[model samples]
Target: MPEVLFPLDSSKPFTDQEKIGHNRWHPDIPPVATIKPGTTFRADCREWFDGAINNDDSADDIRDAPLNKVHALAGPFAVEGAEPGDLLIVDIVDLGPIPQEEGSLAGQGWGYTGIFAQNNGGGFLTEQFPDAYKAVWDFQGSECTSRHIPHVKFTGIHHPGLMGTAPSAELLKKWNKREGDLIATDPHRVPALALPPEPDGAILGSLSGAEFDRVASEAARTAPPRENGGNQDIKNLTKGSRVFYPVFVPGGHLSVGDLHFSQGDGEITFCGAIEMGGYIDLHVDIIKGGMEKYGVSENAIFMPGRGGPVYSEWLAFSGTSVTLEGEQRYLDSQLAYQRAILHAIDYLTKFGYTPEQAYLLLGAAPIEGRFSGVVDIPNSCATVYLPTEIFDFDIRPGADGPTQIDPGMGAPRSANPNL
Candidate 1:
């Protein structure tokens, strides 16, 4: 075990922890600690919702999930001698769920994948799944099994959902301006387009009173992926991956949280991924002026590791830009992917899975989503691939039809009252 720089108590609230972390991204939140360039450290992370979400059979927690306080990040661990224009190299050495504990808190031998209700925060398929749903999964070694769903077991690709270097004051201002401008367009929309900085539930490390107020009001919410790399949610960032983040502030304030035991591409559900609270062992180094050296300035870039679960045969589904209602859009890759996922859900229903269970499965399972065609005319073609081995029976089409599996209780659902 490496030095536990930021230790979290699963029994305590995130705010009550000894070493507090900020949910929002701001340069002035201050670093919890400083480390040299070649240091390997361990940081315990709280699940995004802390302990608010229970390991239960209700989707009410998912329905009423706290959207304001999120992505309870571990730190803005200042790297000694790092400066603006430098590139911060982060290597994901290892990570997993909380060890040797089993209880209510997520990652204590279990975790969850949730579908956020439309009124809260709509997901990729929110229009199709307007209500909230949840699937609790139990961990056995490296694999997880869900009672809410059935007949599926697979290895998880453990990784952090949120990790980044802090933005400089100027860069932070840019984020607020753009996101605020976008929000101004649809300020009253349910699950607003972009979240603005809220002062209500901010935990800015050791800052207090007036300073906290100023920082919280101006800080960017940790929902969207920004130049500083807040929540990119790339499932490929498993162990042995190396991410290069552009340093926009002195000391390169690197922070990480929102760990996931497993996630498909896109994290289609808003609360997608087998959300967990876990520890990450990271090795950090600096590339002096490497941002300009690598011709990268804004977004973080990375070389994904090859340690993810391997499945040679995949049952794939494809979709075009046409919407479920038959409305066609031009070169809409995003819409194409959505249709592909919806098609997968529809197909899974043949096996007796409720749409919610199938949707949750697509979000948590290591399904591969890709663009099969984008250059052609009015429609982009997207495809989603599911590993055949994860399921007990054959999912392919033949003279023998789809095998029916018990969906158990199905995914627990809560209808949106606002609807």
Candidate 2:
């Protein structure tokens, strides 16, 4: 079927705390038609700034811009028929990064805070590796110099800052009642969901327990309106990935914000190619039977070769193991891995695969089984992998017969002696 386009505009500026509730923003160009299981729609997205930052802005200008205006989303597109129990499957068809026009002073480039800070301030490395850094580059010139050092090569790519479905009203309300005040009114309440500490005490969205506790504690102290609830700045998702979200209400209230030019895994410096303003094209579909019973209720599915959804896969396996382990060493890393394998077996058996077949596949297929953090106390590990390529093969459905024979016996017997 032909793809439809949906354009959305935000009604008001959304904070990291207020974005949790539903229908916060209105759709500018409503869906020309309803989207179903097979229906596909192309969503056009504007930059996080919503066109605020421009090429003419300087490093000082960027550093001085208001935090509230940083990452703006394009829409609250309605997925017709989407309900609490349904799944919204989004296929990233294509992404077009905003190009840096020639001769434009817009510091259009890709880098995290470290790269930018190093460029502006000649810190530790400037004295020792005097020739390693450069503040600016001449795009047209074939050669460029950085403090007498010569270099070449420049390409810019922008990625989404934040992209996720709206949380349920109940979940949002609970979160607000628990952590709203700290995020809204208390400057000391900035929790560390993913960022690091800046000189200003707490950097919003940082990933730290202390920061998170302060934010949560503050939220409990004073109840603020639903802010950007369920909002986080994850820059790992790029082109060629699929993000599947669970529908919490009819029409699956969907929204996206935060745009980056590029970022590394883990987003170490807490900031990335922080350039704003760009276009994105997203395809929407419905996933059949994609939700779990409880615990964080969102199912994000990435396509083949794209590892963006690794977190979701790990969570699924971890949750299963947690339930199975009960009080028996559930906190142990090695034990958890073993239990996870058992969980996988149980899952496969439910799909009609024999225990033996499940075991074979678990060992042979792309199922990831590994020990990651054994050095730290209460070591933790995981073994789980999803093979997107398996669907492309056309192999026979049943198990093979025994391949060995008993020399003492007259002839070989089937492994399944019952047969």
Candidate 3:
């Protein structure tokens, strides 16, 4: 059995505030616990929102939830045998559905999938889906059922979207300077935030009270993937994978967060996949000079495809765009690709698709996307592939909104009186 360092008491409801882990990735935040290498431990990770998000939440909830508080990580668990110049091999032993009895969420058995509907500044696809949306999923270990959406059902994978070790003070400083240069490239960017004086009450596990005794610079923001590997968002990092990332800090203070039940390739409509808090089993080891051997400047990870769904067949759409003079711009390529998704949305609407239906279809379907290439100079192209087998009926959209979907679509939901 794995060592229960940060154990979530399965006996009670998982709503307790005291048991949650720290959120920030700053070296100064200090380690919550320490362990020797080759040891496996269960990390009780908080949701990306900490614990504030809910089934009843609105788009305003997402837009208003704590912008800077982003991913509520579990721990900076200092591996005893790890040190600088070594590679921290984090073995993803297992992730979970966050047993309904002890998980953070109240509604779904395990998780929630959603889209950010901020009217102002939001995701890359915010303009298209300009409303708050969510679909709570009731997970049964491997398969998940949803009441909010009924047109689909698929097996869920326990994938931890974010995991990484900490960076040294020197490496942290270097990372900040380089990213700052990139931000400087865009003159309109505002001054960076060190540690926000306070985290909005909506998110749990945030740095507050004595936790702010030392605040690392804005460089410690948990979003970017740096040398120490914070948030890579690699979907295939499920079970049985060995992550080989450079260790910059002493003890390789490793942290893990942003636990996802399941997610598609391009989380096109952001906010997240089956967002839930649960236990994670990790077998961590340290490799000396592994970075030099692998020759990875950025963090390198290997994910096995065994534990999740893989693409077999897809109905794909391609987007092509070019300037009048034949010069291809990437922004146009992106726009065209997104437009093709909208086209798929329009096409599926004939079979009765709501905005949420279209969104969930994109999520549940095995959609594959690629920038393809920009080699033509004048024309660049991108492709969005949709799994044709997912739609059992003929190719047409209709009025099958949430309330009208076929009962055969998914497992029975105890919620949703409208159905």
Candidate 4:
């Protein structure tokens, strides 16, 4: 057991923890702890929603989930002697759901996947799934099963969904400016184009009064991936992964949170991954001046870990950049991926799964989504590969057709005021 630097009590609210963590990102938020390079330690993480979501069959919590208080991170633990222009080498040693615990809190032998309502924070397929839905999954060792989405069981590919070094004051200003400008384009859009710094639910480490007021007003939200690597949601960052983050401040203020029990390629649903609160063991080292030494000046460079479940056989579905309305968009990989996902959902319906159940399964399973073509003229092609083993029956198309499964009560749905 490495020294537990940032401990968390699963029973308490995130704000009630002894060492409080921040939800927004800013340079002056202060470090909870400091450590020399080449040190190994453990940190406990709260679920992104800080336990606001419940372990129940209703999707009401998902519909009204507080987007302001999110990504309850465990650190900004300063790496001793690291400075701007250097590279922070983070090796994810080990991590998992709360060990030996079983209770209402997520990651205590269970977790959930959700589809955000279009009125709230919509997801990649928000147009199709405009309402909120949820699927609760019970974990058993490395595998899990969901009653909301029956007839499916799969091994998890657990990993942290958000990790990054703090952005400098200059970089932070740029983020605010760029994002603010974008929001100005469609300020009233549901789910908005981007989230601005709101001081309502901010929990900055120790700052208060005027300082807290200033930072909270300027700090960036931890939703989208930035140059600082905030909320990239990469599913392959499992154990043994190596991430080289560009250190933009002294001491290399690194923070991490939003652990996922499992997630597909693109966490398509807003709360796509099997969200959990867990502990992560990390080994930190610095490359001194490796940022410029490797010609990687911005963003993060990572090597996917050798960990996670592997499946060789897949039933693949591909789609071009044509909208559900049959309009073609040129070179839109995102739209292509969206169409591919919809195609997968359509195919799964043949097996008796409601579209929401299939969508939740794709978001939580170890499915692989890849970009197959982009150079083509009027359309790009994307492919989603579903592991055949995860399903109890054959998923591949054949003469016998799809095998039906009892989808149970189906995923819980919420009343969406927006729709």
Candidate 3 TM-score over all chains jointly: 0.80
For residues 1-419, write the lDDT of model 2, one tens digit per residue. 23524333333222332322112221121222345555555544444434433333133432333333333444556676677666677765555433443322222332212211222222221222111111222222211111111111222223565666555556545554454343445544222221221223222222346644444332211101122222343443566667667766567756554555433222222232333333466677765445653322544544432532232222135322243425533346656565556566566545444433333333322234455545544435555443333322212234652222111211111122211
By lDDT, highest first, what's the ranking?
4, 1, 3, 2
lDDT of 4 by residue, 1-419 (tens): 99999999887898888898999999999999999999999999988998888989899999999998887999889999999999999999999998889998999999999999998899989988899999999999999999899888999999999999999999999999999999999999977999999999998988889999999999999999999888999999999999999999998889999999999999999889999999999999998888889987878989999988889999899999999888979999999999999999999999999999999999999999999999988999999999999878888878988787787999999955355
Q: What are the models' TM-scores? A: 0.98, 0.47, 0.80, 0.98
lDDT of 3 by residue, 130-240 (tens): 555666676766766676665556666567778887767777667767766776676453223222323332122334554454352333567656666777666678888
Using lDDT as the measure, the top candidate is 4
Q: Write the per-residue lDDT of candidate 1 for residues 182-298, one digit (tens) a residue.
A: 989988997789988899888799999899889988988899998887899999999999999999989999999999999999999988899999899999999999999998799
Error of 3 at 405 (Å): 5.8
Q: Which of 2 and 3 is ahead in TM-score?
A: 3
Worst 10 residues of 1 by lDDT: 410-419
What is the clash tally of candidate 4? Answer: 0
